[model samples]
Target: MNKKLSYNVAIVGATGAVGKQIIRLLEERDFPIQQLKLLASKRSKGTIVEFKGKDLVVEEATPESFEGVDIALFSAGGKTSRSLAKIAVAKGAIVIDNTNAFRMDEDVPLIVPEVNMEEAKNHKGVISNPNCSTIQMVTALKPLYDRYGIERIIVSTYQAVSGAGNQAINELIVQTKQILDGKEVTKEILPVSSLPKKHQIAFNAIPQIDVFEDNGFTLEEMKMVRETKKIFGDPSIQVTATCVRLPIIYGHSESVYVELKEEYDLKEVRELLMNAPGVVVIDDPANQEYPLATDSAGKLDVFVGRLRRDLDHPRALNMWIVSDNLLKGAAWNAVQIAEHLIRNDYNESK
Candidate 1:
């Protein structure tokens, strides 16, 4: 590939799905990359990935791969990040990690740049991309939270199988086609891959995501709880979550119930969301205009609608939110952090 700019860019796990999307987005956004290093595991070494109409060979990622690199986007899963993210940062390359490995780390800032980019400025070598479901919710909630003052959030997620990775999405499709033809559908990946039980994810809603904790909340649920506080910078903001995995392949949807610190006019909520960054509010219930996973698929903005005051909880509002699980949820958010770093020069305290 022809060189373009001064920053040496590295994409760890470049052969994987989100890794590839990061590369595609960089090119599509015309990020000025001087050197593009595509790195994956040893098994994926020599795999050819297309970038900017050029074919590039994927290399095995090592600490050495990050030498002289300015930005390294990691999407290789938590273990890979746990092992290599520190090394990349040690070599002076900023690591925008798309994994849960360091998300809960006190030093690592879990970020949704549109919501709290200030956290990005104080990176201790690694900056975490929030859970995809959290990204869309927080982005949509920020405007309201600022204007109306949010007190609590209760969320039920309708997440895609793709959030579990490509294999899970493939299994859902295969099982659907097989069952339609009177064949058996096997379950092995949904809920949790390491768990003893796996459920059929085709045309079914599994109420568990990730492993359950001591409190019976799944890791995904815990992510929503903790990451919401971290992103909102308000630990007092009550957040309860039930995360579910659905058969959809590309998008994630959330049915969110939020109570405001002040009584909010529902129309005002719609207007604020309509103008929020990375958010699109569609609240026309008469014509049935609302957010849907199929419609939100492949889109960048978080689509939010079904806005109304909660019937029983007078101070609360209920709404639906959706976005492409891969783009906005993982790869795109990582890319946005990189863009923010470039824009702000990584100085938040200033």
Candidate 2:
């Protein structure tokens, strides 16, 4: 495909939390767009979504929805993407899907632009954004992985309710108010929404994010493990994850322990992080300075802090990583991939 003065763009799941942020980022960044289309479920059809001070109506996404679209951004659930993403590609659009639907697909490229934008050039029509938790962790680890090869990674995630979708966010807010009022708190939309059991998310930390697999790891945990390898393009690096849902509203934080193959200086490690693109290091512990979820909410950059050498291993280090689950973890990352596609004029033929 030849470069155009401007291209048509479509956003699936236009009413979702991440979808809204993608729209905002595109406008804020002044993305070159000759036309913009908002696509969502049939239930959300006819809803008005404001983009760049103009009202755009949400339309039901169908296989035909991709006609005339040059780029498609999907933040809808995996089911929707699985059903429509291929159709979008067949319709001559490059899909940047923010779903697990295609992340592990051998044909689809899993992308975190800060870490692996080069892989975008090899896309066979669909590119996947890594999981919200995985994106921030890998972005922070990329510089270190290059300077000193990573041997193993152990991560525990304190993820936000927003990652569970708007219903979970509302549950947290409503449950908090109910508890303060001494009223009976409602239990719903947590742990796993489809499962029969529900847990209170307000003032609570659930040890599971997605459903547990046979090996005892939740799907969220496995995604982090699997996607980390795929994104880094190195399956030999051992990774284990424990994903938990916290009561926070926006940011997802991780306690990461990485063992490198080479010994390193703490000062030099700090310098590498400080200079890394799309990373902000705030490690002045003496001044009570560190990355906090409250401070990271709404930010696009991944925040890293609490850097220190591991107690047991000379080459190991521990750090804290934080980012807005909806932005850098989802929307901003998707938009960045879209921007890369435009910049490189990417196509399957390329």
Candidate 3:
């Protein structure tokens, strides 16, 4: 395979939020594309999506979809990715999955390009995108971790409803209007859609994001804990998370506290983050400037601000991180891996 050759690309869940963003980015970044295949479930099969000014009809995803695909990006869900990712791999297409299906698989490379892009070269036909929250956190922490050995990380996330899906975003909008208009609030999707209980997200925050695991941590929180270790290639680093759902519509915000093995100067730490790739520092306390969810929406860079030393812990620091969960956190990260694969000629003599 020639690195300069354009390749056939397939996007699973082409009609979904992240899928749509991936399409936009492919065009925005000018990804080399010989052919583009839009795939969705049967319900969304006939839908048409505009890409590069052409209306492409989405086709139902099946095993044959990957026959000539050089790369397949999967974001449908765990079940869909689980059933089709291996099939795509068997058909000779490298699969970049955004679901939780293959992330923890020992053989699968869980990638955050800024943190550990080298891992992508070792992929056995499947690569996993880390959770949205984990993506931004790791992107911000990587520079710090490389400069000062990190001992532990404690993160509390204010995730947007959009992380759940388009439906959740709609629910938040409707719930807000209902509450403002003094109408009855109806809730169906939120917290955990599969769970029987539902909560209002318009005027409130849900303490849970995904289903609770046996360890008393939500699946979303556990993803941050486990994926951080895998992405960093260090199992000794400790991580804890509390994932919460906020009423925001686009970006995810995290309050991250990290304890480093060595003492660090605040000015040097800020300088390191400013120099890191795919990271933007917005800290200007005098001007009351910091990363905000609204400002981060639709951006590809992870925004970090509010860098301050922890009062009690000499080697610890606290910072705020924000990014568009749908873009850099999911679609852009997947596309970045694809770009890296192409640049490195992943298909040549591997």
Candidate 4:
């Protein structure tokens, strides 16, 4: 019960891919920490993992697991996060959830630090990390939104299989090998494991991500649309998306078209994004270069390219955005919230 912190942090779902990456980022960034805790499900309880030249045993996550922690990072899944986040927050631990648990909660600030760092200070003990696709989109849009004022956004996502999970990553690899060997590809998990119909993602792309809702939009697409408005704090910014699971791994790429409320020259647009923090513009079509998933992998910055204005509508512009889905999309973003807390002199009480 002695949570009198010198930065006692607990990582929920510490055995998962994103959790592992968060641990690495915390260590690599040399985040101020006096104690490090790893918590997973009961099934993964005894697993040992490396962290900053130390071996840490993964404990089963439960309500009591967060008792003495100052900050808790949750990414197990929505169900697990929903069940434990309140418990973590109740115990005086500020929670940064990477799952979609409290994203739509009015009290929680769904944040992307580079776009909105001030929101991090207003936490109700829980801050939601925006969707991977949404994160990159807003990072690319912030400069334009603040300078020219965004009116609308239409995004189509080319997401990697790793966004599904480690099993899905392995599935793509196994299925790809089978295809290359002239063998039949298997299909068990591509677009939601719990759903009735599974699609082959080996050489094909599935246009759906999460299950469909009453409005006919898939949850993943809806997240991109809804979370964009929340992160930008602008309900008037219209957004629609088509989320697809492709054969790639690591980066999530987007083809985003936006119409500004105030018209601006393409040269000014390029200059603004180039000067924006955490965004790299790679827009030189004649040189045969642009943001690609293969090149964006293992990096933290969001890449923007293929920028051009719509010929018919001077207020409209199009561009391509890419970011490591696991890094800036998930782990890095969560770590950034924690960094914001420390830098802003926020206490455990929020």
Q: In order, what lDDT does every prediction score?
A: 0.87, 0.93, 0.94, 0.90
Residue 16 of model 4, lDDT score: 87
Per-model TM against the reference: 0.96, 0.99, 0.98, 0.97
Output the lDDT of residue 188, model 3.
98
lDDT of 3 by residue, 199-298 (tens): 9999898999989999899899999999999999999999999999999999999999999999999999999999999999999999999999999998
**Best-matching candidate per lDDT:** 3
The candidate with the higher TM-score, 1 or 2, is 2
Candidate 1 has an lDDT of: 0.87
Candidate structures ordered by TM-score, highest first? 2, 3, 4, 1
lDDT of 4 at 46: 92
Residue-wise C-alpha lDDT for candidate 1, range 1-350, written one tens digit per residue: 11224578999989776887889899999987888999999999999988989999999998789888888899888989999999988887788899899998998889998889887777778889998889989999999989988899999999998888767978899889989999888877777887999899998999999888999999999999999999988999999999999888888999999999998888888889888899998778899899889998778889998998888877899999999988999889998888877876874432
> Candidate 1's error at 103, in angstroms?
1.1
lDDT of 3 at 264: 98
Clashes of 4: 0
Tens digit of lDDT per residue, candidate 2, span 137-172? 999999999999999999999999999888888999
RMSD each, Å: 2.4, 0.9, 1.1, 1.8
- Per-residue lDDT of candidate 4, residues 1-350 (tens digit): 23333689999989887998999999999998888999999999999999888899999998889877888999999999999999998998889999998999998989999998787767888999988889989998999999989898888899999898888898899999999999988878877988989888988989989889899899999998899888888899899898999999789999999999998999999999999999999989999889999999889999999999898988999999999999999999999888878777555336
Instruction: Please give the RMSD of candidate 1 to the true structure.
Output: 2.4
